[model samples]
Every structure is written in C-alpha cells, then in structure tokens.
Target chain A: MKTIRLLTTLKLALFPLALQAQLELNATASFELSRGGDKSHYFYNEIHEGYSDWRFGLAQANLMAAWPFGGGWRLQGRLLLERKQGERPEQLRLPQLNLQWAPQESPLRFTLGRFLYPFGAFNGRQLPTERTFIARPLAYSYYVNISEKAGFFPGMGDEVKVPADGNTLWGSTMLYYGGYAAGMKLHWEIKARKAWLDAAVVNGAPNVRTGLPGSPNWGITSRFSVQPRHWWKQGFSLAYGTFMERADINAGLEKMKAYRQALIGTDYLIGFGYFELSGELIAATYRAPQHLPEEESFAGKALHLKALAGHGDIRYSLPFLGGAYLAYRFGMIHFGRIPGRTDRWDNGIKRHSLAAGYRINSFLLVQASVSTQQVNEKQWARRQQAFRLMLTAFY
Target chain B: MLRMAILMTTFLSFLYLGARQEAPAVIPGPHPAGVSAVRNNPEAEPVPLLRGDNEIYGLIGLPRPRKWVARGHAYNKDGSKVMHSDDPMAAPNRNVIVSLHPLDFQPPLSPTREAAITQKDQTFLPCVLPVTVGSTVYFLNEDQFVHSIYSLTLRNIAIGRRPPGEVHPRKINKPGVIQLTCDIHTHMRGVILSLETPYFTRADADGRYRIRGLPDGRYRMEVFHLDAGKRMVEVALSGGQALRQDIDYTKP
Candidate 1:
C-alpha cells in the first residue's frame, strides 16, 4: 500500500540521525487522591461518577528527550500523558519543543519554536523540587466568565458561560542572571501570543465563536528582586498585560475590543528564632469593554489584599536534633469589587492555618496540617476546615 | 676542646640560618601575615597529629531558622535532624543520628574502608552521611522495616536490601553523591557521600566543621550546609598549624 512506502522512507530518514546523536530520556509518575466538600448540595455533582466519597487519579506521567547539536544548538521535546475519572481515555499532549541556541559564553540566546510563555515567576520556575507546596498558588485558579450568546452573535446575546480549556500557546524570549551575596538579579520577558482565551470559565454556557480572524494578542512582562542593605529582607514585583480581539459575529452582533490588567505586590521578612514575621500585600485591577443594549461600556474593577504572620516552635530541636520542630501561621484576606459590576463579587474572607512537618531524611519528608477558613457575610460566605497529610521525595 | 667548640659553632650557625629562613614570609602589603605565609608555602609540612580532641566545631548557617522550621513542619520544606533519642530500652541520653535528607554531606567519611550504619526505632541512623569513594557501607537494620539501599548513579557494587539485625556491606567505587531510599518504606531516605579525598567532616549540631591534616598552603575551602550549598572561603595553614573558621548559613 502507499502507506508502506511512506513509513519506509520516514524510518530511513530517522535511522541515520539516531545513530549519530546522543539521546537522553527522563520520566516521572505521580498519583494523587482528593475529596471536595459541598455546602448547598451533596459532594457528588453532575461531573462526578457514582462515587461521591473519594477520587484517585494519575496526576502526571511526563516523558522528555533532548538532542544536542554541534554548536550549542539543541532540540528538546516532552509528552505528558494524563488519565482521571469522568474523562476520556489516556490522552497524549505535547507541551514543549524548540530549537535552542545557547552559546557557551553569551548572555543572549534564541529559541524558535513552540515554548512556554515566560510571563511570571510561576510559569518560568516549574520544577518538582523547587515548589514550596504540593499544589500551585491560589491565584492560578481564579476563573472568568464569558457570554456564549455574545460569542455566537458577535455583538448581542445573553447566554453567559465559562470556558473549560485554560492553556495558551505562545513564543517568548527571556534574560536573567544572578548569584549569592552579590544579591538577586532582574528578569525581562517578551511574548507573542496567538490565542485569545487563557482561562477556564467558572459558571457559564459554552462559547463556540471565541477567536475570529485577525485576532492576535501579545504581552510583555518584567520582574526584579534586590537585597537592600537593611535590617529586614525585602522584595517587590509587578506585572501588566493587554489582549485585543477583532470584531466577529456568531449569531447577530459584532464583538470588538481590548482587555487589560495590572498587578503589583511586595513582601518582607524580619526577626529570627522562635518569633519571626513575614507578610505580603498585592493589588490587581482588570479593564474590559462590555456590550450594552444601546452602547458599549467598560466596567468590572476589583482589588485584593492578603497578609500572614506566624511564630515558630523550636522546643524539639533544642539540644541535639539540629532542626526546628513546629510553626503556626495565621493570615487574613480581603476582596473588593466596584459597585454595578456583575463579573466578580467580594465578601472578604479570613483564613487561619496551622501546619507541622518533619524531614525524615534528606530526600524524604512527611507533613500534616489543618486549616480553617471563615467569611464575613453569611449568605455569600462559607466556613470550612480541612486536614491534609503529604509526603514528598526528590533528588 | 678548641676543635669541639669550632664544630659546635659551625652547627649553631647552620641552625641559625635555617631558623631565619623559616621565619614566616612577610609580604610588604596590607595582607594578613598568616594568610600571606600560607599562600607562600603551598606544599609546606603538615600539621602535627594530635590525640583526644573529641570536641568538634558545629555551625548552622540559615537565613531564618523559624521560617524554615515552620515550613518544614507544614510539609512545605525538607531536612531532618542530625540526632534523635526516644526508646524504652535504649541507653539514657544516647543520641541517634540520621543524615541524607537534603542534598548535603557529599563525599561521606568513614573510620575505615567500612562505614557504620545505625538503625533504631524503624529508622536509619545518621540520616546524612559521607563516605570515601571505593569504601564499603554496611547497612545494619535495627528497625522492623526491611530496608533496601539503591542509588541512581553508577556504583561499583550492586543494589540490594538487608533484613532487621542483619548487616549488608556494598562497595561504592564511583565518586558522587548517591541518594539511598527504602523500597518498603517510601519515606525512608539517606545520602551516600562518595568522595575522592578522605579529608571531610560533617558539621555538628551547631553547623561547625573542621578538616585537619592539611599541608601548609592556601586552600579554597568550601562549606555545604543544609540551607547553603558549597560556600567558598580562602584559608591558609603553616607547618604544624591549626586554623579556625566560622561559616554563616544563609538562604538563597
């Protein structure tokens, strides 16, 4: 068949290349079990199968390979396979691939291919051993709502819904350098994006006509950290982005406009031994054009502040353990939204968490913690408590 | 008597000249005299061997101990204690040590070609350890858990496990830090410091460490604490010299 000749030719082309080069492969597998609590209804929702009690799934199975060229040029690829309950069978996804030219003694490098967007600290620094907690920060989970009818009609419609997929594709370039005692350095990143939607919908109908022709967006972000000569340690960070979409119609209306957001934050650490204090404050705002009955308008501006302070327990590590025993953290968070904006609502939540952990060995660890959260308003607020145990090992 | 006195004078002159030459080098600069002398003599005589100096210096270099401890207790961080003691039948106040929790204590040191393995209360004793390359490390299981020792790096010896109260010695020829973990108890972990030189020591409870018997010279000294990696410090020693250094642990 014609397929046989194509396969034979493809193998011939790859055979010689494989024999002449060195290939390095690495893989990781993780399993996780979790349970969610419900206030208004049973824990089981439409998304759950017959089991409302507990769910177990394969969290990650990532495989990666890299091939080096003659002069600091290399090709790298990675494939991630994931499987969970209430989803399709095993699915394979390609997350990264690019031609990288990192010379031996050059501060500047280039990559031309599909690569991760170098936007913030989270996206750029993602190694299993580097993260502080088991799960990502809470800011990564905040959702957005989009009207499906508006998506379909382009200008006017009413079925508001949330998107399911959240990953965005983009190309980026970055520069960074730093070392100990000399203090921290700064980072500069620029990215060109080809997708419009980067977040999942919280509660809304499906929007089929999300991206139209000529709808391209790009973003630039920069961050810097400095160790000032002072009694306390200090750090500051800021990020800004804008997205534009071309006018398009799904049912009857034409949708056109640009969306933007800005964020700034700072943190400080002071004291030592049994009593130490650390806190961070952040403020963020988003700007977007909304379609009204007679004319288009812009609304929906929000801000949030979070802070935490804690003391350590060094009783157990006193004479010989050579390690600290326990530490308790208490924190509060407040959310505010502009009046007349239906996009987001704020009730100002207060949270308190007490965590205790032990390092069993250099590469192994065990920890147990309990947290309680309370909100101000009864109707809009919910009180919850959680206990968690975790184990992690790395090289 | 005259001949004897003449010969004695000649010997005395030779000794005086030698003493003058051995006087520490004094570079006409702002540099410390000891530091300069050490730099001038790279292959000078080694320090005289001393006995019964059981006291070792300990140093712990950490930016914020409270923060790290809290994070560790909450299971957000990693590292274990260097000592533990809590058993009904165990010796009173006898401390049990563990190593190999963090990426530290590389190139472990052994008293002999054979290293000691401590097992107590279902845990590996001395969680972090360093050993000279090509030496044999014995794993004596004192706990109930059946423990297995394996390293991802290439080692001259094969990987296997030993049962409780049993001793298993495996030769490690390769020079590199190898992580040891137990298959039965996933949480059981340790480090094997396979080093090229036999002149390394683990920091004590206070994070103080000393490597003796170094010849007179200027050495690029490096210290690796749990929170800090190999921090470099320049040190100089003279013939039969004793040097003291203090390293501050800081977070990166």
Candidate 2:
C-alpha cells in the first residue's frame, strides 16, 4: 500500500538522525477525578472534560522528545493524547515543536516553530505535570466572548449562554490558555554573578492561516531578576502583544477595523527559603469597527472594550514532611460592559483555591485541591465549588 | 497535525542530506601559544638521593587549638542542661593540610586519577575532597532532580546542570582550594582541594597524619589549617631514623 511505503521511507529517514544525535525522551501521565457545583465551568475548556458531577476522568499522557546536535542546535517536540470530552474531541495533538540555537558562551539565541509564549510564569510552567495545583489560574484560563454574533453583554445578536451543568462558556479562550504559537523568537540575556536580565521578541498570537516564519501580529517580553543574598531570588516581568482572532476575519472588513485584541501585563516572582510567592496583573482591550451593530456596543457606538484580570499565589514546602507542600491561589477576571452599557451588565468571576501535594517518589506525586468560584451578576452568583484529586507520574 | 507531519518530514530530509555531506564539528584551536625552554634535562645524570645510612621515618603531632576552650553548655530539647560543658574531644580537627617540600627535591610527575563526588538527597557526599593537580573530579547526581555544581572561586565559570544519574567531570589543573555551590539547592556546599605536591596529607579526626615514601633528607614542613592557622618548621632526618616532631598549635 502507499501508506506502508511512506512509513518505510519515513523510518529509514529518521533512523540515522536518531542514532547520530543525542536524543532524550520523557513522558508524564496523570489520572484525575473532579467534581464541581451545578453552575461552575472549567477554565480551559479545550483541555479538561467536565466538572459537574463526580466523574472518573480518563488518563492523559504527554510525551516529549529532544534532540541536541552540534552547533548549539536543539530540536524538541511534544505529543499529547487524552480522552474525548465537551467540544474538544479526542485526538492526538502536537502541543510543541521547535528548534533552538543557544550557544553556551553566547548571550543571544534564536528559536523557531511552535513554542510556548514567554509572557509570564504561567507559560514557563504550563504543563499540568509541572504545576503545583490541579487547575490553572483564572487569569490564564478564563473565557471571554469573542463571538461576532453574541458578545458578553445584554441584547447581543444571540444572548450569551452558560452551560447549566457548569461548563466553560463557548467562546475565545485567554491568550495564556495552552499558550503556543508558530513563529520565530529572538532572545537575549545578560548575567552578572547571580542576577540576570532576559528579554525576547516574537510573534505572540497564533494565526492558524498565516502560520510560520512571520505573522501579522507580534509581542515583546522582558524580565529582570537578581539575588542580593543567598537563598533568595526576586524578579519582575513586563509583556505586551497584539492578538488576531481568526474566527472574526472577513473579506469585507478593513485592515484597521479588523477585530483584534491587545494585551499588556506585569508579573513578579519571589522565592526565599522554603516559601515562594508570585503574582500577575493583565489588561486586555478588544477593538472592533464603529459600524458594528448596537447589540455589540458599550455606548451604543463604542469601538473597543477592555478587560482586567489579576492572580496571586503562594507556596510553601515542609522540610519535615519529606516532600510535601501546600499552595494557595486567588484569581479574578473582569469584563467591561459594552461602552454604553450599565454597571449591572458587566461580567466578572473570582476564584480561590487551596491545594496540597505529597511526592511519593521522584516519579510519582499525589495531589488534592478544593476550589470555589463566584460570578459577578446576581442571576449567576451561586458560588461554585469543586474538589479534585490527581495522581501524576513522570518518567 | 498535517502541518506538523510535513515539518517533521522536512526536518528529517534536511538532516539526512546534511549527514550525507561532510558536516564537520567545530573544535576550538589549541590554547594560547607560549614559548619556554627546558631548564632541566631528565636524560642527564640523575641526582642521587640523600647519602644516608637508612630511610627516615617521622611522626607529626598536632595539638588542640588554644583559642577553642570548651565553654558552651550542651542542652536537651526540653531546655534542661544535659552536660556541664561541651565535649573537649569534639573540638574541630582534620582541618589541616601538611606538605613536605625539599630544598632540592623536585616533585615527580604523579599519575592522574578520577574521583567521584556524589549528590544524594540534595546533599553532597564526602563534603571535602583533596586531589592532586591534573586529577579529574566527576560530580555524579544520584538524586532524581537535576543538580548544578559550580566553582566561582578558582575558574569563575558555572558548569551548569546535570540530570540524575549523569556525571559531569572537571579536570583540576591549578593548585588551590575551591568551594562548590549548587545554584538550585543553596544549602548544598562542597570543597575540592587541589594540591601541587604529592607529599601531602590531611590530618585525621584525631589530628594525626602520615605521608609515606620520603628519602632521608631535610624537609621544609608546611602546615595549613582552617582553625589552627598556618605553621612552618625545618626537620632534618638521618638514615633509618624515626623522627618525632610534636607541634603545639595552642601557642601559635
């Protein structure tokens, strides 16, 4: 068959490279169980199943492969496989595939292909296996209505709907949700003893159509960190980007009038002894044409709307507990009403989570968390609570 | 997914083509050129050993530090006094470096050997190690997580991180005491003592040391200790004579 011939050709092509280069393979597998209130939803709707009733979730696996060759070149790729749920169908997805050239002696480097956004700490620790808690923060996982037909306010073309079973809204997710984009990045760093200044410029948002090499949108990220004394490190970060919404692209829309989202955020991380504290604050503005329908407007003719979100968390390790730790996080997301809309129509959500984890061994971990979420509007103000337990293994 | 598959195919093809071509690895040139003429010839008449009747043997005694008088009281967890005074025998020892250098003795070339300093449970095993110059020390990580071992005192360069079960080797070519620290686990600290002379030994926990295989001659004995400080003395040895030199660091 043609498929068999192609497979044979591929194997032969990869055999030599695999043997010649230094390759490393790693994987993480997890089984999770969770339950949520009647009206709560999963922040990253594309990833998680559901959170309504007690459900025995299926196992999820992420496999990564890295090949480091001569000339400071490195190639890395990750494959994710999980069960089907919600609008996200079961499938094998390549979450990351990139090549990097960072020489050990140089302060400048370049990366290309699909790589995680270097905006904040969230992007740096995006994988579930690396996160301290079972769930992601609201600032990185919350959903906002970007549907041209139905906005987040009242009297839109179609009224925005929330799943009765407490599932995430069907809308455009946050930029940090599964933050990966296909483009190029230039990174630079200057180190002085224990301190460093890191900066980068890249095509921030994912444009599925106008993929690789370059995109219509771009962003910048920078961080400065220093340790004044032993056992302590503190750092701050600033990021800005303009994101394009592919779903809203139309032939009739003008380039300037095309719907696009702009974001600016500041973040910080501090670690001392057995304790670590980190937080981030972000503001996003979405602009549309002035000729849009009144149903999507704030002042009935406004062209832009802004949303503000913030998150903070603290974690501590108990030295006597062998490898046990506790973590707490608080997050809030606010959506401004259409320019002309009243305060009552504004949308927001607040979440608080407490989690504890025990490392059974280097490869295995057990974690449990309880979280509660509250909506802003009185109609949907029922405090939503959820409990989650996970067993994760990395090898 | 299709795009990724295409990308992978393209990358594989490129790699295969590159491999077929003469792609050479980049290796830096030799160290900076320096001109030096040999001052001594090994093929010439060898210098005879000390004209003595017998081999010289010696014992060096190390006295307790005088400033370290037992004063602190030992207490139990309940705030009750357990001991009236701290253990005198527990006073710090084994911190001294003793070396014997002859006025005309040229240290023979010593064979280089490899040694390992292991990382287990986020701590370094055998916290202090002494190795001859030109010897290589391999830092092995036994723990699951990655560990970074660096010495800024001598080389001023970070060796970077090594994963579990991996070994990172560094050849110590200079004679100096270097302190190693882990960037991730700040509590972990280690020391590597690189010595130029083969006739050197560190004192034991009881302040006793012995350096074997010395011909009958006069030696300029040099002693360096972190707590006891430094001391120097000239010792003359005759054939088959057992010399006993007791050093009282308490006065110095």
Candidate 3:
C-alpha cells in the first residue's frame, strides 16, 4: 500500500514536469497465430502433435520525457512496460524503469533505476519487430526455466515447491559510444539473486530433489559488439554469476560457486546478395563444489555453435509483386565431460533447418520452415515443421 | 567625260529610287516622356514557357486467378469449384493473374493477366523486375508453401506472406538497388530496383518500349537489368518527333 502511495505521489510530481517538456509515448503490439509440432518436446521429435496458439502481447509501452536545465544539465526518464508468459497466466512483471542525467550535451551519461542488463547482443536490442526470426534463437530461449516449481520437485523427497519466477532484479549503468557504427560500450549490473544459475542447474540435472531455490541468489553479465567494417559485424559476450542458499539436506550443501559463459559471433555480407553467412560459437563452463560426500569439486563445461547462410532474393519488384529470399542454418551443441571422468554421457545435439519467405509489403509477412534435430542417440531424433503468420505495424 | 557624266546620272537616279521606295518609316528615334522605347521591341520581350509538374501513382491490382491450384488446392477444369484435396504429390499451378507495366504506359483499358514470380522447383517466379517509384507491389506467394521476405538495403522493407492464397503488398519509398531474401527459405530470392522518378518504362516481352507524351526536352534515359547496373543514353526530343533508340543489356 505504501509503495502504491509513493508511486502515485511520484506520478503526480512527474506529470507536471512531463507536461512542461515535450513528452512522447510510443507503443507496439503483436498478434500472432502459430501452429507447430510439440512445444514441450525436443527439436528432433519424429512424430508430434500440433496445436493452435494466439498471443496478443505488447512489445513496448514506453513513456519518455526529458527536461533541460540551465548550463547543459538535462534529466530524462523512461518508463517501460513489458510482459511474457510463464507456466501460469498471472506471471506478469515490469522489466524497466530508469532516470538518466547528462550534463548539457556532455558525452558522459548517468542512469539510476531498474533496467536491462547489458549482457548479450540480443539483450540490448530485443525489439520484437527487429528480429529476423519468428522466435529468438534456441540458445537464448531454450533451457530457460520460467516456472515457480522448486528445482528438486521433479524427483526426490516431498517438499512443497515454490514458484520462482520473479526472484531476480538487477540495476545497471552503461557508457555507450559510436552511434550505429563501430563503437564500444561498458556496463555493470548487480542482480538481486543468482536465480539463473539455480534454474540452469535444476534444468540440467537428471535427478534432483524438490525445495531448491527457484530464483538466482545473485549474479552479473556483460557483453560487447564491434563492427569492424560496413560488411563485417562481430561481437563477444561473457557472463559470470553465482547462486547461493541451497537447502538440499542430503548433501548438506549451503552455497555453490558460480558458472561462466563466453560467446562470440560474426556476420559478413558478400557480393551484394549473391552470398552471405553468419556464425556464432559459445563456450560455457560451470564451477561449483559437487555436494556429494565423495566428490567435492567444481568444474563442468559445454560448447555450442550455430551457423547460417543466405542467398538473397533474385526476383524483386515484379510488376505485380516484389522480393523473395531463401536461407539455411545448421547448429550443434556439445557438453564437455566432467573432470576425472571418461564416460561420454551422450551429451550432444545437432539441428539442420531450411526456411523460405516472401515479403508482401512493409506491414505484413509470411514464413514457413522445417527443421530436423538429432540428439546423441537415435532414440531422441526428431523432425519438426512450423508455419507462422505474423503481422507488425508501426506509426 | 560625257560617258562618265551619264554613268553618274544613272547611279544617282538608282539611289533616289531606292530612297523613295516607302521612305523608311522612321518618324522619331526615342521619346523620353512616354513609355520605355526598349519595351516596344518585340525582340526584347521574353516568351514565358509553361512550367507544369504532374505525378502518376496507381495501385497494382492482382485478382485471384480462377482455375488455380495452390499447393493445397484442387481445381476442376469444368469451371466449377471443387473441394481441396490432400494429395501430397500434387503440384500447384503457377498461373499468376497480374499486370507488370510502367506507370506511363496503360494497357488499352482491357483486362489482362500475367504471371509474376513463380515458385518453379522452389524459386522465385519472375526472378527480376524493373519498377518505378511510388508504385505499389503485390507479392503473391504462388507456391503451395509459405515464403518469408527480407532485404539488405537500408530503405528496403520486408513483408511476409504465405502461399496458397496469401497476398502481401508493399510500397517502395526510396530509390536504390536492393535484393530480397526469404528468412524461411534459404534458396528463394528476388531482385528489385526502386527508381527515383516515374519516367521509367519496362521493356515488353520483346524487349521494346514506346514512350510517348514527352515534351520537347533533353533527357538521360537509362536501362537496367536484374543482373546488371544502369546503362544510360542521352537523347533529345522535339515537338512531334519520335526518337528511336535500342538498349541492349546483353553486353558486358
């Protein structure tokens, strides 16, 4: 209640200030109808069930207001609203709010409040309309656990599982240079808890008890992108974080050390549209004391790589219609063997995909694609096909 | 001496006859009190040329074709609607019903149909096109499948449409060279050239164009192809003059 009162008061105070300045509101929404094979199964499922889906969602509802003080001091604030679906319908949250100050056309900027953590290339620029793929890459979306059920709930002892959706929040400040061209940016964020690590462990583990932390105990991530030339774009990203507060009674584990991941990617456009290629390689290492009584070590690692090639549309501006293109991609993920162990646990997966699309206009798009995946063992092989109808509008 | 005097008299008589031939109407040289004498000379006044500008803009209409068999459609040749069949081996027909003409050249007020980009073995139907600015383009995925469209040009915008009766239309706002890509299909591609001015005309099937209604002026005419850059030619047009020129893009 007090938080609501404070928010109302802040709104009243800021409303007048916003009116004094020229404030602007920009919003976007997407209505998508999609049908695809099994949503819960791996990408390589041989036979799958199709289901109809409808998502009426807002990409952004941003209120931006800026005011100028004498002698070059300026204040700006952005209130953003974003939401995503979880296992439950009521799992909605506000993802951003920040107040910024720049001293009169100065190159330096300062920001305060809850904001996005500048970690990966996609994190900073995850606008829905800007993405080329109907869905984000599997590396970003897959293995992401958005449920509240405790980590150990799937297996062992009886413990009431708690939903861990909103366990982590982070604040970051960044200095950015180079407009759209080759530039550098530096950022730092301190998360409320290391919830991501907890989720990763629970999702990766084959068998684990219930009542584990659903959210990260605490962590931080950083990334950078560099465009050396007009045609060559490259980027590297790194995330190092930790999770604490373990309640597993059998192992008597209290806190585990963090894990780390490094990613590098490059894209090059060659010969106008004759040929183009892009690839990304990610290496992730996990470190935490294995709570087993016999083994107390902290070391595990994984490697993932994805690549795509495109031949630009050759037929454009037909008297009646215009533009078409074809593209293909191949991806693989491998899990490294644990230290002091030689057994290969069949920890690898490969995916091959083919897709084609045509542009009707600036406001509409239609695409269809088929992908096949192969896990380490043939039993897990899967073939999947999807068709998407998407529409986006901007004013 | 007598002959010389006769010759002089004859010359004087000719000179007098020349002077008497309408007395060279020169009443006065200049009148400073009234109007500017310079203005009275028609040669000193300039003719005002007409300055007019007009824009031609229209929509490219593509009525759905009859007797069409989309990837998932079954059509009857007897002019009756038939139920769509689930024949996996069925090949969708590529009979596009659209007109591809420059804005300056209008078809003789007669309904006509033409096939645009065709999905032959999963490729774009037309492969290339020459388009003028402010022209609306409609992309009908003539295949029995879906196609995702994207472009590399900064001004090139993409719109997505699926096959089997899906139509997507877009307007090119900028003039440039661009290539379109399908994010979904790796092998499907198309080319488009957004022209700056509407004074462009596409060559017919025989690679010919007869541009009319051109005012007398000098213009730099350019020809382009999907696989080539622009080839320009300079020409002058006069009133009631038909300029003949041939553009051959077959040269390297």
What is candidate 2's CAPRI-style docking category based on DockQ?
A: incorrect
Runs of candidate 2 exceeding 4 Å displacement: A1-20, A44-51, A82-89, A147-169, A193-242, A246-252, A256-258, A289-302, A344-346, B1-252
How large is the interface RMSD of candidate 3?
A: 27.4
Best by TM-score: 2
- In order, candidate lDDTs are 0.37, 0.55, 0.35
lDDT of 1 by residue, B172-252 (tens): 677665665443243344555555544556554445455554444455455543323346566555566565665564544
Candidate 3, A164-262: lDDT as tens digits: 234321100011100010112222212211111111111111111111235333333434454444334455544434433343322333334332222
lDDT of 3 at B229: 48
Ranking by lDDT: 2, 1, 3
Best by lDDT: 2
TM-scores, chain B, all models: 0.55, 0.58, 0.49
lDDT of 2 at B229: 52
How much native contact recovery, as a fraction, does model 2 achieve? Answer: 0.00
iRMSD of prediction 1: 21.9
